[model samples]
Target: MDEVLNFIIAAYPDDTLKELIQIKLSLDKTGTVQVSVSNAGPPVHLDRIPRFEPSAPTESNLDGLWYFLAKNFVDHLEFRNLGMDGWQAVLERRLSAASFEPRKADSEGSIDEEIAQFEVRPGRHDDAAELVDLTYDTYGYSYTGPDFYHPSNLSHHLASGEIVSIVATADGVIVGNTSISYPPETPCCAYLGALMVKRSYRRSKAIELMISETVAPAIGNRP
Candidate 1:
């Protein structure tokens, strides 16, 4: 029971546990366990809720218990700044195995001239709000993931140098953005995330331009 509570706290760090109206846990003699939680808040919209399908636990399931819990019960789950060493190692190993190899860049002189119409550069602290607005424009409010969608969170990441962002602006309006974040403990690796482009410009080769002009240069500068 304590383990389950700890797992909940770890998975939903942003939620207030005190607001939960009820929590029920049941474990049978066969080792099958069930948990139900009710929180005092606005009723959850059905479309927003994640459906859970029961699966018998097996030894071959490499993802820890938290994975199942999050997939079954939560809208989203993120494991950041949680001091669970073992879980972090498992997550890192899984991510590293699936990581893409950084691509090489072409010489500037050989690149497409059309890319010059859009400015591609490293993002600044002041760009956080614009970045969030770009995200909303791209994915809408229902988008839930690890990307920092708020200016304050983005600012914290930028200040810490944990993330390096690249933005593409056309005539002073941001139309595209992407970021690569370094895991503090992983010196040789970085995770690329939050790649987005306004719908009208999706076919403009903006992503390729950002990768060539921004991502490649930034990654090369890393020690």
Candidate 2:
């Protein structure tokens, strides 16, 4: 059951609702396994319904696994467990089936070549439409969050200075994005979230660039 436990841990890295979620796994004398997930948190909002449906044990249903954890849990998700071949196979199959077009590494030569064509800078209100499209392309309808996925909502957040968004543009097209959310009560601390890069650019140092160039500057500028 270590694999199952690892899956859960990898699925829900953020403890945002950790204390509110409980997981139970049981195996009877007959060897039948049962898994249960319960939410003890406050009532879920109408627009933010959970999207996870448990998959049958016999099949390695990667799409079901990702839908449950990524779409149902939160808008932004990342996984670093590179050694899990099973999970990786699932991702490859799913992305191919969905016709997800990520940047082609073979055509781009080296990582440096790819990074050279991309530019990262503070996001503008005009970027709201492209950013919304990027989120929709990445997460689809599963991400119902109004903050970043909606153009008007993103513009409001940007205008109010509640969120500092950094956008990556390749050939004048928005391809990668990340943001830092500042809590009004905690002046010194900022929550870095909404990090996403187009599948094609993921092989490059885009994330590192966002952290070092955009996120760091925003946090340092906070008073």
Candidate 3:
């Protein structure tokens, strides 16, 4: 009985044990073993709450995103120094000064071979819907407000030629996207946004591929 309990406990990490557990074992005249096992804890439930209901995806953009994160970020921005005017000024200064530290492996990865199965498309369309979903999923609640626009809005910018957008799809799943918008009014440069990848697929080289193929070309760049 002890051996059997040990084996079962080793099998499931979610299983619980109490300091005191009752185990019963019996042997008939034939010398066969019978064992019983029980975990000492509240009943376990594996039901998943449906978070991605119709409410989540019914509209183009989820409105409460900034509100949700602001519950922590901006709400305490004054107390904790997040999103404050000074902080915003500091970040704006940093964003203005930040440069791409282009430490190449000396060579860029091949977009064709790396993202071969994935299609790199110009501008934005209905196809980018899933990439938007991937963005929310990857960054959770942070992909909103002044830092970036919603994925679909980014697509609109791409379609209008207001900005350049590129989305990467692998086997029909939108894994990542890259975008940069240049306004003629702002002559020196523009901003890059919507650069994201799914959490599980981040280990793969998908983001680089998308950047090289979609975003790089949109800005009249050559990799």
Candidate 4:
């Protein structure tokens, strides 16, 4: 993820003062993994999404050499223009052989009812404990990110301007969280960080709102 993001940042023009970037990782029951990167700079037309035949892996000087090497391994790669929304590149790969049952359709509308009450806001110092607990509950120590395992570390990072966290709460309890980080070398770019929602709140808009309504808008307002 870091390698791909850095390459994307390098492609941006040097004069831009601000940028909005989003990365989404999705996994389906059939075990296909998709990584999407979107930027709020320009809309790339659908016709511009690469459609060239695969070439043998070889040395090249193209700016998109990383894309070439990656496209060779991933099952699918495509780009899309989102009009007013921005541009996106999606890469997909199948990783699992076993399939699981799909989620049940929302017939009773309970999922909507539950998410309607979520409150999104920037995270605070006091939110550290709950954030760490939530991470543990979700990943059971298997999560590779070490900072999330320590509340003090999270608080420190939040204080040092290393990250900005947007959290979704229900009745004042954090139910979902996401973050944004600006790479020092890329002043015009910001990277989307990890997003996690409580098991019970996974079906809600808590994740979406944290990114779209809170985090992105907050970064846009930065000086």
lDDT of each: 0.59, 0.58, 0.49, 0.71
Top model by lDDT, which number? 4
lDDT of 4 at 44: 48
How do the candidates rank by lDDT, highest first? 4, 1, 2, 3
lDDT per residue as tens, model 4, 96-152: 575677665434334564536988888776788898988876678886667778889
Model 3 stretches astray by more than 4 angstroms: 1-116, 144-152, 184-188, 214-223
Q: Candidate 1 on 1-223: residue-level lDDT in tens?
A: 3433454444443566443435555444444444554443333233433333347555554335544565445333332222221122111111213333444432322324465478887887778888888888788875454455778878778767777888888878888888877778996888777578876677677888887866464452564
lDDT per residue for candidate 3 within 79-144, as digits (tens), equals 112222211101001122333444444134424444446666664555445755766766766865
Candidate RMSDs in Å, in order, are 18.5, 16.7, 24.2, 15.4
In model 1, the clashing pairs are none
- For all predicted structures, in order, the TM-scores are 0.45, 0.45, 0.40, 0.44
Q: Where does model 4 exceed 4 Å of error?
A: 1-116, 183-189, 214-217, 220-223
Least well predicted 10-residue stretch by lDDT in candidate 4:
52-61
lDDT of 2 at 99: 31
Clash pairs, candidate 3, are: none
Q: What is the lDDT of residue 99 in candidate 1?
A: 31
Q: List the residue pairs that clash in candidate 2.
A: 103-200
